[model samples]
Target chain A: MNTVFFLVFGLIVVVCAINVVVQRHPISSAISLIGVMGSLAIIYLQLGAEFMAAAQIIVYTGAVMVLFIFVIMLLNAGSEEGGKGPLTVRLLGVPLLLVFLGLLSYLIQRLFSDTGPVRFGDFKGGSPADVGRALFSTYLLPFEITSVLILIAILGAIVLARKELD
Target chain B: MPAAVPLSWYLVLSAVLFSLGVAGFFFRRNIITMFMSIELMLNAVNLSFVAFSFQLKQVSGNIFAFFVMVVAAAEAAVGLAIILTVFKNRATLNVDRIDSMKY
Candidate 1:
């Protein structure tokens, strides 16, 4: 069951991630990124990070992606101009990327050879209550700091995005 | 009984996603698409974090992933605003074209 869930959602994530890159228009890419995030949420559930899964949906797919789409729309972002760049990049880009991916997988597999298979229900500490407790207690400082970070981001965004007065 | 997925497989998937994100960042000319690629990379890392959290039987990985998500949110807000400013000044979203500071 766990394997099946992982394969299905994992496939969705990979395909959508590729779509996000391959699509020409920014809006199309944004929507594809949302697809990637949604499938990742399900994978999070399979991994027993239930709270993270919900937050992935609400914060990432819901709020962050909405902001992305709004920016694309407001800017009237058109499709990328047609020109695949120079010959070396066009010819070698994908093959080099594949090599890089293969190298990363090889390294990860060798490093994690001793770890056990991930079983569903094995980690029950990912519930919201558990995460909230950790956030408020052990991670209290970081949590408070993130609020300040967010406040600064809000102010920065407003200042940067507002109209330029004469 | 259900088949077991090795922990390395999850890491491998994360690697693949991260690589794709890198590919997008380098190959795509559009600024927004490039920014989205950065977001994709962040999500890929978050997956790895959660998987390690599950492996170690600790909720700390999930907490870390939560923090990553919060930071990604803040980043998106500020990043989009920056993109808007860039667009207003340059009137083009192509990353290659936006290079006015190229010496």
Candidate 2:
């Protein structure tokens, strides 16, 4: 059951992630990324990270993706113009990417061979209560700092997007 | 009972996604697509964090993932604004064409 769930959602994530990169129009890419996020949320649920799963949907799919779409619409961005980059990159990009992926997978599998399999329900420490406790205690300082960071981001965005003064 | 998935599978998936993100970042000509690729990379890392959290039976990894989400949110906000500013000034979103600073 767990394996099936993981396989299905994992496939969705991989497919949608590819779509995100392959789609020419920014809106299509944004929608594909939303699909990727939604499936990843399910994978997070399978991993027993319930809070993280919910947050993934609410924050990423809901907020971040919406923002991306809005920006695409606001900019009226069109499909990517067809310009095959430098000859070396155009010819070797896909092959090099495949090699990089193969190497990374090989390294990860070898290094973590003994880490054991993940069984759903084996770990219940991902509940909101547990996460909240840790956030307020051990991670309290970082938590506060992120709020300030968000404030700065908000100010910077507003200032950047605002109309230029005469 | 169903068979368990090895932890490495999740890690491998994360790696594949990250690599794809890198590919998109380098190959895509549109600035928004490139920015979305960066977000894809961040999401890939978050998956790895959650997987490790499950492996170690600790909430710290989840906490870390949470912080990553916070940072990603802030980054998207500022990044889109910058993209907007770039579009306003340059009137284009193609990364190849917006090379005023490239020497």
User: What is each model's TM-score for chain A?
Assistant: 0.95, 0.97
- For candidate 1, the chain B TM-score comes to 0.96
Q: In model 2, what are the clashing residue pairs, if there are any?
A: none
lDDT of 1 by residue, A1-166 (tens): 8888888899999999999999999999999999999999998888999999999999999999999999999998889998577789889999999999988888997899999888888889999999999999999999999999999999999999999999
lDDT of 2 by residue, B1-103 (tens): 4498899999999998999899999899999999999999999999999999999999999999999999999999999999999999999999888998998
What's the TM-score of each model vs. the native?
Answer: 0.97, 0.98
* lDDT score of residue A145 within candidate 1: 98
Best by TM-score: 2
Deviation of model 2 at A96, angstroms: 1.6
Per-residue lDDT, model 2, residue A98, is 96
lDDT of 2 by residue, A1-166 (tens): 7788889998999999999988998999999999999999999988889999999999999999999999999888989899878899989999999999999999998899998878889899999999999999999999999999999999999999999889
